[model samples]
Target: MFAEFRKFVMRGNVLDLAVAVIIGAAFATITKSLTDDVIMPVVGWIFGGFDFSSYFIRLGPIPEGYTGSVNNYAALKEAGVPLLGYGAFVTTVINFLILAFIIFLIVRSVNRMLARFEHQKPEVPAAEPTDVVLLREIRDELRKRPAE
Candidate 1:
């Protein structure tokens, strides 16, 4: 059992998968940061600097006494309101697009490199010509026969 376990651990495919998982996790973090911290804010600034996150409609009812705009989704939800978080969904979609684009570029590069390697002609041993072999055989026979 120990030997089998050792073999499984030492397999090339397993090692490759472990490395891929580590790298993928690291890449995910980087892309998440880029999407959330950098891209979304710029997009938010573009449309009259209105923050989409603060945009939500209150469904149930606005209290007659309380008159203030609900700046967050949680506040509206607490007021017995059904909220549609379209902005959050858009942000999530952006994150997915960024991550997917990064992955696509990586996969494309790897595929190009692999395709280049695959298309390279392999060195093959030259085959002996049939006529050459026949000629050699005839020469050998002439030499082997005793002089008349």
Candidate 2:
């Protein structure tokens, strides 16, 4: 059982999957940073500095001892207030779109590069061996001659 488990773990596909998972995790982190730190801030500025994360509608009455800001979604949730978090949802959708667009661009570029490489490949036919050529010539001569 131990040997079977080791074999499963050591397989080429398994190793490739593990590497892919690690790389995907790293890529997700980078994309998240790009969305949150760089793009979101610029977008916020362009849209007059509105924060999407804090945008929520409280559906239920606030708890009696709650002193947190009414506009804060996290605070309201902590206070056990039922709320609709559309702003957070919108932010997540935007992030997904950006990430998907970037990935599409990357795949497109890779495909184009692969196509170019294929186009540039040489199409010269392989040279026939001298022995095969001589044998063919003999065969042709025999065919041309009458039977003895």
Candidate 3:
């Protein structure tokens, strides 16, 4: 059973999948940072600096003994207030779209590069065998001779 497990783990596909998962995790982190740190701020600025991070609506009343600010979503949630956080949802959607667009551009460029390479003809030709060369020369010489 141990040897079977080891064999399964050592298979080329399994190893490739593990590496892909690790790389995908790293790529997700980078895209998340690009969305959160770079794009969202610019989008916020474009929309008059409206920050969606704090956008939430309280559905239930605050707890009677709560002393925290009512406007704070975290505080309100802590105080047992039911809330709707539409802003966070919107922000997440925006992040997904940006990440998808970036990935699409990368895939498109890579595909174009691959196609260019595929279309290129090889610079060097393989040498023909001596017999084929001699046969072709004989055939050409016979064609060049005038009939008697």
Tell me the lDDT of model 3 at 128.
98
lDDT of 2 by residue, 1-148 (tens): 9999999999999999999899878887888777777877777777676565567788989989888888888989887899998867767788788878988999999999999999999998999999999999999999999988
lDDT of 3 by residue, 16-133 (tens): 9999899878888888788777877777778676565557887778878888898787778767789997766777888788778888999999999998998895668889999999
* Candidate that scores best on TM-score: 2
Q: Write the number of the candidate with greater TM-score, choosing between 2 and 3.
A: 2
Q: What is the lDDT of residue 84 in candidate 2?
A: 93
Give the deviation of candidate 3 from the true structure as CA RMSD.
4.3
- The C-alpha local distance difference test score for the whole of candidate 2 amounts to 0.84
Best by lDDT: 2
Measured over all alpha carbons after superposition, the RMSD of each candidate to the real structure, in angstroms, is 5.4, 3.9, 4.3
Off by more than 4 A, model 1: 1-10, 57-69, 74-82, 120-122, 126-148
Candidate 1 backbone collisions, by pair = none
User: Model 2, residue 93: displacement in angstroms?
Assistant: 0.7
Q: Relative to the true structure, how large is the alpha-carbon lDDT of every model?
A: 0.80, 0.84, 0.82
Worst 10 residues of 3 by lDDT: 46-55
**For candidate 3, what is the TM-score?**
0.70
